[model samples]
Target chain A: MQIQQLSVFVENKPGRLAEITEVLAAANIDIRAISVADTSDFGILRVIVDKPKEAIETLKEHGMTVSLTNVIAVGVSDHPGEFSRAVRLLADTGFDMEYMYAFISRDKGRAYVIIRTNNGQKAAETLQENGFDILSPETIYNM
Target chain B: MERYYQPEVECASREQILAWQNERLVKQVRHVWDNVPYYRKKMEEKGLTPQDIQGVNDLKKLPFLTKDDLREAYPYGLLARPLADCVRIQSTSGTTGRRVVAFYTQHDIDLWEDCCARAIVAAGGTREDVCHVCYGYGLFTGGPGLNGGSHKVGCLTLPMSSGNTERQIQFLIDLEATILCCTPSYAAYLAESIHERGLRDKIKLKAGIFGAEAWTEEMRQNIQEKLGIKAYDIYGLTETSGPGVSFECSAQTGMHINEDHFIAEIIDPETGEVLPDGEKGELVFTSITKEAFPLLRYRTRDICVLNREPCPCGRTHVKMSKPMGRSDDMLVIKGVNVFPSQIETVLLNLGMDPNYQMIVERKNNLDTLEVQVEVNETLFSDTVRNLEKIEKTIAGALQSVLGIGAKVTLMEPKSIQRSEGKAKRVIDKRNLF
Candidate 1:
């Protein structure tokens, strides 16, 4: 399963992050998880919100740079070896992972690995076929 | 290697370029004298004939044609050929009365598109690339000019003429558009849109050709950083031709005119004396190959400099910097000449947003200029006092920098209409023409 993530193009400045959050708060869109990938000139503010469509429209109406993307969100055991085993499997399957990060789930003993890979659909299919539980937008947004 | 659609012949050594121009100039003069009634009568009024005009150097002997001349001539009166020979017409839209139109025969259109093709090639476009034409279609020269040129280069074209930013993003991502052509302001808007849609990394656009409105180096840098693409400046007017009259190459210093089809001149607007290279003055152009309406020495009123040095791209045709101001658009306030570009420079230098709309009106016989600038939400916290402070600070800055009193209004971000085509930055309602 692939989760829909919102990536906002934010000019790197002091209060840009706060401004974006303010818009989301006013729209009542709950942010489940967030991370910012940044360079000196700009940043991609990635967000998983309860209402992706509402959050995007609200941010856009407020003049914030935003984009939507499909990313693989895989459930993993909280134990240390979980991430390595998943990576090893994907590597064995010839899937190249661009970048990935982890977010702790509200549910105990489970963590989610948010990954950007070259082939998201095929990776999701293979992960599902191999008994790895793939999280959908509904699960990611709620978490 | 940098591209050149045709070997530049205009900058060929003094003897050869002029000799070639003289031959064509003689033919153009005879054509005008025989076909166009306006030029024929104007020449006759000065007690001159085609025989009196011998060469390109004698261009000054001919009267200068301005936009007003086009308006006076109206639709097809100035056309040198019959309607059957004219293949297309392109017009410029101004807030002032009656838009100025230019005619192009099949040959003229081909030459114009060739000039556009050369501009694209200079900016690193190729047949394998996909071109996204975002310039507004119909009544604007930018869309079709680039469209025809991209087709000539065998590039897949996306004629996505202005507005509907969502669809623009979709096509840019889906088609992997490589080359983008549009006004600079629209490019900035598109950059904002792509980033918001999370499609910045998905876009394959390598270069953007921006023109039609005046933009600053700061704006160019802003767009380039946002979109991760090279930004090139282009210059043209409907009076001469559309967007490919001149363009920026990899050097990015200035726009190189396609002198093989258009003759470029720089003249002092007031004294009318032809200025030397590097002297900032009004730009004038003569259409050498336009058959339907071959305008001779048409004054463009754009203030800029012409560079003759060979660019790294290897085109010898002279290059012109982005126009500093227009002679007719310059405002005389308290006897000090002020152009909108100067205000833009000050606004950008202060680290303020450039989404400003200027209002010039006369109050009690004194000219008053009010600048309404939209505050960037990311920079300004939502507070009335903060907005007031910004307004006061901008007013003080403008007062000191321009040496004139101005009222500054800080507006909500995105409240100012984002321009989809050419940015209309000035609104002189007082001059109600």
Candidate 2:
């Protein structure tokens, strides 16, 4: 129950995001969810695309430093206090989350949150054990 | 290995050396006063004449010559000899304003080569030894000085002027070059390259004479272990003829100045007050024998102490410690001189803010220059690809200006530390012992 995410090292400059998206669009690789972690000098653009391998290869060919990271995608109820419970469960189980971003699924009345943890497998197992729906690569990529 | 190059001179008595200096200095002062009108004005403004300078002790009475004086004098103002009489010119790598050119007569060239020959001999060089000179030729003094010295010593001289590491190593192995002459940094680079190629045992180098820039004892040890050779430090400047002003003997304590031709002095850089021996201060050199571009009481701006202690190598010449620091902000990167003002000028001309930091480090035995510049909001908001392009543009501009490549890192505005009094511009992390 892990999804492959593309992490790109990007210098903090104008039109860089557009260029990356342009490359992905040109390659017909659909980005499902995207978030950027920024520092003063540079940024790490984390992207979940439909074809992770293709996206990585295309970006690498353009001389970009891209890495494939395994992250757990958790399906949570799109309601108040529901996301907090899942976060609390992970916290109680000593699963330290590096970063996380959420996007609601259009078909179902549920929200899917992508989380990068220190240990992805252990976090996925812990979430599943606590009766939360853990997303598989196929499900996340398809969504 | 034999120590002194000219025994009567290198191991000359203090009284004898002083007498030679007194006579030569008096003659040189008079020569400059009669020939160089620019220096004559400086002496005239101070209400002094050549007659006022009787000996080395009266050197302080003479007007001090600095880099500014050299710049103001420019091409011909400081030439103490007729243009037709001078044979050559060696210049400082002018990364800043104007290049300071020092003319050399045929006799001057002979003396300069003789000084370099003394350096080689002091480093155990002989006629049987093949001297490989990799210092850049042309206007730069390092290569020509050593090449001529190698010929003077009867060494089969290899005039491989800088760069082309593979070819240099191939020649080193094929020719069995025993004495290597180049900048200390280049020596380190060659040593690293040789080790990386696994050609340690195939080489036959026994000693290296490194100069043209500042190096530490730690760097010396590091290069020595890698190259399996004793690295000797040499000291010189274009103003005082090239490498051979002073040289380190087998004792390796400090470089002994060629007192027969040049007189070394220590002075408080602020007040110009002469300091006694063993006191660390600004080094001053008075060329008693230079003819074409003779300078009196030329301020070197190098901070070091002079020792009059008898050397184990039997050279009675006064020894000067390796330059501890510079009184100015001049930096030597990869043996090329760089000033922070030069970098600032490049940045401002490009419409960028002058807030920047230069980081110098020795990686893989080669000096790496990284320029971290603060990016404006517009640049920071640009695409990563565009930002990278800008970085490359800035790097290219710096390279064109500096004559050396620098890695340009675009940083956020206000990220660099700002100071109220003096801005901390350079961070040199090369641990020098």
Q: Candidate 1 local accuracy as lDDT?
A: 0.79
After TM-score superposition, the amount by which residue B21's alpha carbon in candidate 1 deviates from its true location, in angstroms, is 1.7
User: For residues B21-61, could you state the per-residue lDDT of candidate 1 as single tens digits?
Assistant: 77887888889889999878888887888887788778777
Q: For residues A16-105, what per-residue lDDT tens digits would candidate 2 score against the true structure?
A: 889878999999999899999775668768899999999989987775667778888999987898899999988998988778999988
lDDT of 1 at B203: 92
Give TM-scores of chain A for all candidates: 0.93, 0.97
- Give the best candidate by lDDT: 2
lDDT of 1 at B425: 78
Candidates' C-alpha lDDT: 0.79, 0.87
Superposition TM-score, candidate 1 onto the true structure: 0.59
Error of 1 at B135 (Å): 0.3
True interface contacts reproduced by each model, as a fraction? 0.05, 0.03
RMSD (Å) of each candidate, 1 decimal: 19.8, 12.8
- Candidate 2 backbone overlaps, count: 8
Q: Model 2's lDDT to the true fold?
A: 0.87
